[model samples]
Target chain A: MERIPILKLHDLLLVTIQVDMHDRLAMTLQDDLMHQIRRTRARGVLIDISALDLVDSFIGRLIGEIASMARVMDAETVLVGMQPAVAITLVELGLSLGGVRTALNVERGMQLLREGSPEEEASGHASIDH
Target chain B: MPASTIERLQVACEEDLVRVRQRVRTMAAEIGLSLVNQTKIVTAASELARNMLKYGGGGETEFERVERNGLIGLQLTFRDSGPGIENIEMAMTDGYTTGGGMGLGLSGSKRLVNDFAIQSAPGQGTTVTVIRWK
Candidate 1:
């Protein structure tokens, strides 16, 4: 079973989707992400989809679910680097991803996570207390 | 002087879905389609393939490079030999779904292509064909 690598950058967790995703991999990433969020007690999650060229309803729903799950577990999710064509097709497919925030790239996503987190007001560390 | 080639694939499970998408991307790129065009067709393929897996239990997909009326096109046909859709009009409805899906599979795939057609009967099977031009 291939797992999506999760990188922890201080208080933000980043998962860049570099491979073309399948249903199982998508589901696995969802589970792994949830566990990492709770274990790390992170303040934000950044999912970079720059490498993903195609996204369907299942993958789209998985993404939305990740955002919702992360929110429930006390974190904000920012999705970045969606391709123009993927964006167009997703809108037509009726998956709005209302729960997740959008960013242009990973750098911007990192900035958003840092600024959006409530813990950012403190010692630059979004610990379990927040 | 190049000859049109066709590729066939099975869309039965999760892995198949990914393979079909990858195959479509390669085929579309080979046809000299733009990035946006390639992505559109691949996304549409994913939706239709999932529909076939969920509703029809499994299906076959065919890809062929076509040239019609001076338009170079990539066409895909998905066929399922399972419980066929009785009402395509209702199935094509934006919010209508037989399975636990958004019901955008058929309609969305239709919108992403230059040409679309479907043939099915209650007991026969379902065949959805779509073409995107480059």
Candidate 2:
């Protein structure tokens, strides 16, 4: 019944995970983000997990799935603002979060998304950087 | 040498699982565990609590403040009375799951703590105990 709000910033979708999400809540977030992507036709997704104190394998897998799903929808997903302790714990927990792009913070994540695909930029789409 | 009971919780659903993690974090911090250690213990608690709820059909968690050899530590015990695991070895192996999960709960949680123990059988339920020194 509870939902995490997804904000749309132009061609990007911004999500800040501020609560200690339950399993169903995390699953709902994944479902909601996918639908929003299709509806808004966003080009990128920025997920801020800075507020999350713990990311167990369930949440970790959902994040990976969200990234993979977003890629299939032609959108980039960047995870941002992981705490140093969380990063260490995640590695020890044996979750590499492989194939998920990450940034130090929201600003860097937005910049990474704005940079566009390497091939797209190489083809002179760099001038359209917003 | 002696341990003090800190808190006890009933973990039956997602909300309880969140409470388990938060309580573990708070207790870990109260015992002066470093930030990294607190994160590790809390993550481990999250994994084990979810396993109890999902696979074990809910369970009980007990937090203890333990002192061994003059070192203060936090100890957690999770007990469940649902369907017991048939093969704990396979379950403890990474990427092994009977419940359509990533299967990192048991094995991964073990790695995050200093001491870990588990007991289960085909008909009997499961009990997992872990301790992290500060």
Candidate 3:
């Protein structure tokens, strides 16, 4: 059983999706991500899909589910490094990953996670900015 | 002019969906489709292949290289012999799924390509054909 490695960096979990994942592998990723969250108690998750050439509806739904699951577990999930084509395909596939926050790249994604919610930063709520 | 066959593959199980995406990408790239175009078609193929396996109980896929009017394109057809769609109108609608999916298989695939055709009847199975021009 090939497994997707879940790396922990401080309070964040980083996942890079590089393969054309099969159904079982997707399920395994979800299960493992959940367990890792419980064990590491990470505050944020960053999923990089830049290398993924194709992501179907099943995978799309699973991503949405992952974000929701992370949210329930007291963590925020941000997806980054999505190619332009993947964004278009996801829209056509009827998946916007509504709850999953997105960034242009891992740099921005990491920034988003390091602090807190982007919404909070946007509304001038969090006054911890230097 | 008849489209030339590029490749063929089996969609017998879940893993076959990955094969479908891989083959679709290879043929799309062979046809010189842009990266965005290749991703769109491959994504569409992925959704359709999964539909065939999960609902149609397995099927086969054929890839074709189409050239017409100085434009090149890639075409794919998926055929299955399991239970067919009971109502295509409803099935084609977004957010309709009989197999616990997000119901993006039909309508979404249609949006990804330039040409789309689907034929199905209850208990007679389903066949979907799609084409994307480069």
Candidate 4:
């Protein structure tokens, strides 16, 4: 089986998961990713899902949970490069990411992370500064 | 034989998921969907089957072939006599799962298919229908 690759860049973590698209693997990876986020105290995370062909409810929930856990650890989680079909399917299923952020690609996600600080957003400074 | 047919599948908790997967896969393939679409349908069925076993108190799944606008499609209905959802709106909301379900099961399954519907009332059981077109 192909492994999901995790790469650390600057203060962001990039995870390139192979398209196993299996619920069990997705859940396990979600757990592992959460652990990594907590351990590294990273500021941002970009999950590349361009390779996945399918994502069910279980995997979607795992992603949502990862986002929530990342938030508690003061990290921002961004899902990037989701296929159009996958996006449509996720919407049709009525699955929402709660507050997890999403971007079209990793570059955009990283840019978003760099542009804003947790204090600026949390303290309402960015909103006011803009 | 009619162009479309509906068959009632037995419910046996988690064991029923295997049957649901097999039946949905066969139906999805028969409709000429691509491998990706087939996988989506199978995943949807698995999620629903697990839900049926976990919350719906185990019921029946109905598989049918449908045609609309000259296109062939696969339709599935899951019905259970378990405790019905007290709040359909809340139940459909993401992150509002009462059971251990990842809370994405219903919504995610809805996304995988072309048409989705859910009907439930407290003490009246629950029914979910999903359709996929080729």
Candidate 5:
């Protein structure tokens, strides 16, 4: 077990997950983050995955699902700091992340969320476009 | 290294996915895989395990270490005796998951690892092998 680190910003919340990106932990974190969104009604979310070495279909789908749930709650979700290899693999595997927003880094994602409109941020639709 | 270092794990149904994944993670780490490699192996294993439980009924997972040309790698084999796939080529195609959820498991898992192989027939079963080098 590891200490899950979460940071709250003005309107965006950042979660730093330290555990290996396995199915159980990913699903648990996704559930907890959604619960937090429903409870706090935060405007946006930034997931810092620079520490994550791998991103698979299950985790990718879970992230997309959480983003969709957040949208229903009127919040936005952005995946930040994806590794180059992970990004390429996700694209190659055809994991459809239709409605989820992504950024090169958390700082950039936060800036995009702060500057972009809800409509733009809400673009993460639940489709397997890939 | 000795063959004793290799670990074999078995699980039944979706309930055992977590345990199977944990076992694979531990073995991957013992092989000295980097964080990135570890993530890829774990995710790939999860995708296969899910398919085994959901589509294949139940199955066994084996974890072993392989060395080639002075390089070490981790190998995982997922085998199930459930209903086999009819069109393996089509199933490998993107967005073609028969069970649902974006249908990204096969293709996604393939891309996450260094080596990927799948064997299946209508009446037999499905066997998937994935490997990643350290």
Candidate 6:
């Protein structure tokens, strides 16, 4: 079985999708990411899709699902590095990726995660202690 | 005007959908389509191909380089032999799906391309043809 490697960077889980993914691969990634978030207690996930030139409805739905799932799991997901062409097409395809956070690049996405991380605030300290 | 055949491939599974997208992108680029146009056509191809696989039990896709007057464009035709759609109008409606999907395949793909056409009956198969001009 093929899998997309998920890397833990400090308090964030990073996934860069470089290959053209099949339906099964996308579903697997969604499941695996949720497991990793629970296992590592990661606060944020950054999915870089810079290499992908096309994002159809299926892939678009999966990304939205992953983001929503991470939210329910107490994690933030920031999709990063979407090409301009893909952006244009996705909107026309009638999938605006509502309720999903997006960043121009990885650096900005990481910055967003850091700012939004629950561990940064004093109130968050109480939750981390549990 | 008569269209020139670019390529044709079978869409039998998930892997074939990926191949269809890649080949459509390559063919779109070869015809000097802009980046946005190329992306739009490829995305449309992906949606239609997947629809054929899930609803039509897989099918065939044909690509063509079409010229109407002085404008050049790319056209795709998806044909599948499965339980055909009974009501295309309802099927094309957004958020309407028989399969467990987002239901953006038909309506959304139509928005992504310039021209869209569909032919299907109760027992017969379905054929979708779309074109995006550069």
**Candidate 6, B38-128: lDDT as tens digits:** 9999999999999999989999999999998899999999999988999999999999998999999999999999999999998899999
**How far off is model 3, as Cα RMSD?**
3.1
Query: Candidate 2's residue-wise lDDT over B64-122, tens digit each?
Result: 99998889999999999988989889999999999898889999999999999999998
The CAPRI class of candidate 3 is medium
The candidate scoring highest on DockQ is 2
List clashing residue pairs in candidate 3: none
Q: For residues A1-130, could you state the per-residue lDDT of candidate 6 as single tens digits?
A: 9999999988889999999999999999999999999999998999999999889899999999999999998888999999999999999888999989999999999888776744556555222321
How does each model score on lDDT?
0.87, 0.92, 0.88, 0.77, 0.78, 0.92
DockQ preference between candidates 2 and 6, better one = 2
- Please tell me which predicted candidate would have the highest lDDT against the true structure: 2
lDDT of 4 by residue, B25-107 (tens): 88888889877677777778878877887898888999998887888788899999989999888877766788877686777
Q: How well docked is model 6, in DockQ terms? A: 0.89
Model 5 lDDT tens row, A1-130: 5335557676567886544654556777877787777666677888888877566677788888888988888778898888876676567667758899989987799777776675654785321222
What lDDT score is found at residue B79 in candidate 4?
Answer: 93
Best by TM-score: 2
Task: Compose the digit string of candidate 3's lDDT tens values, residues A1-130.
Answer: 7999989887789999988899999999999999999998887889999998777888889999999999999888999988888888788777888889999998899887766867756875433334
Taking the tens digit of each residue's C-alpha lDDT, what string does model 1 give over B5-70?
778999878899989998999999998999888988998999888888888899999999999878
Going through the candidates in order, their DockQ values are 0.66, 0.92, 0.77, 0.23, 0.32, 0.89
TM-score of chain A of each: 0.89, 0.93, 0.88, 0.82, 0.82, 0.91
Q: Identify the superior model by lDDT, candidate 1 or candidate 2.
A: 2
Candidate 1 segments whose C-alpha is farther than 4 A from its true place: A117-130, B1-3
DockQ (model 3, Cα): 0.77
lDDT of 6 at A113: 77
DockQ head-to-head 2 vs 3, winner? 2
lDDT of 2 by residue, A7-77 (tens): 99888999999999988899999999999999998889999999877888999999999999999998899
Those runs of model 3 whose alpha carbons end farther than 4 Å from true positions after fitting are A117-130, B1-3
The interface root-mean-square deviation of each model, in the order shown, is 1.3, 0.7, 1.0, 4.2, 3.6, 0.6
> How many residue-pair clashes does candidate 6 contain?
0
